[model samples]
Target: MKLDALGMAQSTLVFVVLGLTLLAFMWGRFRYDLVALAALLGSVMLGLVPAEAAFNGFGHPAVITVVAVLVLSRGFERAGVVDLIADQVLKVGERLLLQLTVLVGTVVVLSGVMNNVGALALLLPVAMRLSREHNTSPSLLLMPLAFGSLLGGLTTLIGTPPNIIISSYRGDVVGENFSMFSFFPVGASVALAGLLFIVLVGWRLTPHRAGQATAEDMFDTANYLVELRVDEEAKAKGLTLQQLQDELDETIPVLAVVRDDKRSAGYAFYDALQEGDILLLEAGPDELKVLEDKVGLSVVVTPEEDDDSSTIEKQPEHKKDGNNKDDDDSPARQVDTEGLQLVEAVVRTDSMMVNRSVRQLRLHHQFGLHLVAVARDGARLKQRLRDIRFQGGDVLLFQGGENEISESLATLGCLPLAKRELNLGQPRKLFFSMAIFALAIIAMLLDILPTAVALSTAALVSLLVGVLPLREAYQAIDGPVIVLLGTMIPVGQALETSGGAALIADTLLHFGSKWPIVMTLTGLFILSMVLSNVVNNAAAAVLMAPIAASLAEGFDASLDPFLMVVAVSASCAFLTPIGHQSNTLVLGPGGYRFGDFWKLGLPLSMVVMVVAIPMILWVWPL
Candidate 1:
């Protein structure tokens, strides 16, 4: 059939550029955003995308909605909304199967309403704490939780960037976007099936690395942290760390004594433990269980299999105060007026802290941060927090204000291990935060406002109502993702406007000429899923939405089913950690190898495809 196509020269150039761009993304060499930016510039420079419209993608509805969702997710976090839910997940008892069910279920629900990555980050610390409390390895919970986030994101329009992109693409092509809940039927159905597999069977496929890996894998700490609970009438109440060691005769190293929220690290050996003090021990899972059986002391933290030895107590470095050169400053001396926040961070290889003691740097006096604990390598650090010399890969716990901790960590060349828990200084407006988010969803459902406008209004209201601070709202937007979306959108437009997408659709149609229409739909779904695994899902959606539209036109079929298929498949990035941010976030903490994801991910992927295609056809119709 005679059809419109770009000039051969232009189409070839577009093909060459896109081919290189995909290669760059798969190589994983440069950041995806940088690669997208390069593609946009190349298209503009080659006159494929008009120079005037090169940056229009930044203002795309999809990008705005993505940013708004991220901010709103942060607002929910700051308001203590999800944390309250996490408290319930913690109370679900100690059974691994039961724990996986509740934890994955909670994440799935949360992800449908918020950014999936943010939902995972909010629950990650809780998962770590749960492992310590249950005496199991984090590996069993983390991968499932990450996968749950991806599954959950498939269930709603704002749940993931790909959904938003798909919906917006419909508006550009068909003169109207899919309604907010249009995806709910197919998406929610597929999510339930995927989650069923994850909680029931997929978690078993994950590696159990609690005792096999370093403490750094759990919380990026130096040693396994087991909390020793001291009861009022407990036999170990008045005993010192040294006395306990002597009594046990096995020399278990104590890392710190926690009273209330105060932590005493590098404390004197003769200092007696109080009735309610929680002692942080450096022992692993096997020894912790053994200690419980041997002594009357109950283990507060969960056990991981380890019998590792730790070094104890270093001498504190004395640094002179500026006001009085003869007076030494204390690391724990003056608490900041803004309030204290406990933060976990990992020192970078190039940190100025390397080989430097906290006492020497006067961390509290200089940066308003107090070093609470430090762990190096896989070994226990015996030295006190103040006396210990910092090393690369050392995990540090610090006490500082919300803003101060962030700035201080950056200055010290440290990366935070978890999302900052609500800043103590900030207010938690749970009612306002939830109400705002709900109203935004309501507006979109009622068609009173579009998705982008509603979400942007909700985010703005969240900022104004103190649900999330202005500074944090800015931080909530993922920079690389925003850049990638902004750049890729224009290039995607170039692909369609230049007839490149139609050309690809023609080839796909030719290949399926003798096949059933259902087979053609499956081919598009699989293509989108595989591309998403190797690149950003947003990019996958950006590239595939036009192709889906072209294919729909070529087959004289309804575009809704084709667009719906693209939306679902673009989010089925379960095969690799690089496919989605949720997977990458858990990799280090879960101690997961690159290939570990597919162990669970492969079966889970099959489950999604099995469920999604039929559901999409039924819900959207061919």
Candidate 2:
């Protein structure tokens, strides 16, 4: 293999891009997708890939493959396939561990046959609902469920992006194909073991900080105290405050009363309400508005101008004014004219500030959000100011200006916490949707249909059969990932075509020729794992697959073991969220520290390697 100066320059550019992306990931400068696009733009500037091929990855079969998988997953979701499973499996009366096991098991089983991230998306909301109902921290369940999804993807070729990339590379390397279940035994073993760990003690070990609060806590309604008018025609116009309370369930209290410009400070409970009398009450904004409407009353404009005041009354005529404007300066939008307001956000596990105190993140200095109270389960932090290490699922009660809440949460990889209150509006064509997907996978595995053809067919069927809206089915696929994957495929092909992989392989093998085949495979696995964490896993697979095959050739070993090693190792994205999509999704939800992964993931990766090696050797034999 030979490389001209241009080729070397291109390779150098690629390496530089990889280095910068790693630094950006560590620095939290931008999204991983954005970083990759930036690197691609850099490659074009350096003329690494010709202008024509710059956008080639967008059209690649692999890119199409990922999109098709996403659409298919959505089809299944719309068909109520996952919801059906949940209906039967997510029983409320089950033991905690049993419930987790059933939920995690279903997620794993489903993910093993589909995109793991897609599987997680379907189950996440269900888990949130379960957590609320069980009065437990979602944090305790989400991490284990997420890890289960990752493990489950190991079972099938199309389950995760890396596996598909590895199998495609196998065709390029040894002129062989990976069967749908070629790696199933080994992958399934590891998945089962990992799932057990998650069910038995993993969820239990997590901090159950989410105390007793319901999902409603995440959307804290603003409280307001206002006085209302009693119109002549209103039902409560001549009723006493105590009489009105008796009729309307008495949840609201009439705090004060005023009539004929005279104020009464004593409890207004027994005071009679006249047409012009004022009744002061405390309630949330929505509640107050509803009460005003129901009572045919107008809001008191000022503290002194109660219902009894002789002033311009009745609902004011609609007019264009600064008050009606939606801009930040508008008083209507002002929760805190003092520049402080309350908000709620979920803590992500991978946040750099996770496991750190509010003082450590310097909440006010860095993000301008003051920690008001931290809620876990339904329980509020007893000592909010002094003791609290943010963990995943701990909902923070925040005091900050509008939009600062979102900005601050983004920095922590957290999100404005949301709960799934399902209103199953309609049931789509479930049977047809499931039939199409099942047939597609079967056809692909039977060699009667190519995977791309099968999946694309399934996606189309979903639209035609009314399982997914035509607009929405297409919308489910990520455009940037499609572009990145499609564009990079040809570049990777050019690398292999030019013997760049062979050249790299020769150098590695030359230095370790005396090493046994197992050791050689292990070395390649380690290299693949490291590269996948820093760069895109699919890109890492493209770069390393051919090298792994070349190494097998040098050692006179079966290419199957080497290919499987590349597949498994590339998917073991344990070190960083940037390594995998599932990891990134959990970053904000788990409230995990960036450094926290290596604690659990590093050990899991080792277990995968140790378990996979023997299985690969036994099943595929070197």
Candidate 3:
């Protein structure tokens, strides 16, 4: 193909925009959305993408479907559907292989319908508990579970970002979008084969990490030891420790008793509690709040009252006085406490919090966060928490709203020590959420509506009927992902329009012309897979789709086979932890090293290639 001056310039500009986008994504300094927006604006400035059509990608059917799927995933989470299944995951036998089979299998099925990362998150704790119970290394379970989620995403249109992008590309090429189940024939075959390999042989390839500890060991609750004072009117004022334990659902062990200025040697489990007595307790941040509310206990803030405490003095008069004026009228007070969470975090060396105390930082007033407990290595600090200086590596337990806690941790330069457990909302809506989701899937399969429309309608119903709160529905949509798709879609179109895709395809075909069509397809699949591991999978798909279509056109072959290869291979990012979100999610919990992934991932990738190529060719023959 020959290109005129304008055509050549447009193609060159598109290539430059794409190259910079790839660099920004790989750089990891800026958020992906920002990088994509920069690329989009650059394209418009260069006349590659028209300014009038710049925002069209946001309204693209694929983007809408992704948004709807994310909202539905949140609805299912809030409805406790995943939790109900997770509860059953615990009942699977203690035998390592059996437990892994059940756990990985369940996650795979869930990932097929919801976000794969969410599926991994839902089952992570269950996997840890199973490991602790069976005395098996968590390393064996986490990686396989992560892999299973990735595998499951291949089976449906809404399963993964790459699949959605591929389907949208197909719609543009063929004039009709793929049905919800179109990916099923090839995806299911690949997933089943991959699952078998993971179960029978892939797991054995994982490195045996020694001294695998449970969550309790990793978090080290003993370091969070602090004292709570018993109020005169407290419900447990006269109760023995044993009696108190029976009354409360969660265990808050009394490690010692402080009477006057003297401390007891050990837990006084048989001793009766008394007013004004300080009970040294071992509990996480959330547990401390529950104990205070139930037993009328107060955190014994031991730091001397500072006369010039600006944070406290600057508070609103009503809040400063701690008076309950119109408690019934205050919606903040009426809000359910279920959303409140306790999390442990570690201060990094470069954290702004170093050398500052909680009182000085005014954490409670500024961020709505409370420092419930602090842990320092070597020895315990005897001073009050407010007086204790923060240092690098100090482990602190923070209590606050889940969202607030996450934001505050990031702002304060703290790394979370554990994964926050998913909050399965009120149990009443589980059936409703599931029924609505099923109906949407049915509508798509029956061709009653387009995939995006059916999903969007279902998401709207979920919000209207209160399956998911409005705030949560918005939060559920991954903003960066949406922006990446919206921005990259136009760039991809530019590649096609400027004939850059054809140019690249022709250049590659020159070397591959003599190779069999099957080999060419395999090479393209392998190329997409490799690129996916190094960059974002969605970006990989967006970039590869144009070239895949161009290659089919050049070879006079069916586009289905080529696009299928792109979809399947783009999701197979198994070579490294950075390749997929699921892999990174398990990195800390599994105690895995960067190099550890390829041990099992290498074989699994080989298996996927062997299985997927045959399946793709058979289902959508070239």
> Against the true structure, what is each candidate's TM-score?
0.72, 0.68, 0.73
Which regions in candidate 1 have their CA more than 4 angstroms from the true location? 1-8, 212-403, 406-428
RMSD, each candidate, Å? 12.7, 13.1, 12.8
User: Using lDDT as the measure, what is the rank order of every candidate, best first?
Assistant: 3, 1, 2
Write one digit per residue (lDDT tens) for candidate 1, span 1-622.
2222444466667778889999999986566788999999988888778899999999999999999999999888888888778878878888988999999999999999999988987787778777766777878998999889988898888899999999999998778888878888988898899878887788889988755133333232322344567887676778776577656755354556778877765233357777878776545444555566655666542233232322111101111111222222222122121222456665643356767887577675588775655654323355445457775446676766666667777667675765434332334498898889889989998989999999999999989888888977886777778999999998888778778899999999999989988898999999999999999999999999999999999999999999988998898888887888777666655667778888898888888888888888888787
Ranking by TM-score: 3, 1, 2
Comparison by lDDT, 1 against 2, better one: 1
* Tens-digit per-residue lDDT, 558-595, candidate 3: 99999999999999999987677778656655667778
Rate residue 14 of model 2 by lDDT.
53
Tens digits of per-residue lDDT, candidate 2, 419-438, equal: 43333324547778768888
Please give the TM-score that candidate 3 achieves against the real structure.
Answer: 0.73
lDDT value, residue 237 of candidate 2: 82
| Residue 327, model 1, lDDT | 28
Instruction: Quote model 1's TM-score.
Output: 0.72
> lDDT scores for all predictions?
0.75, 0.65, 0.76
Ten-residue segment with the worst summed lDDT in candidate 2? 313-322
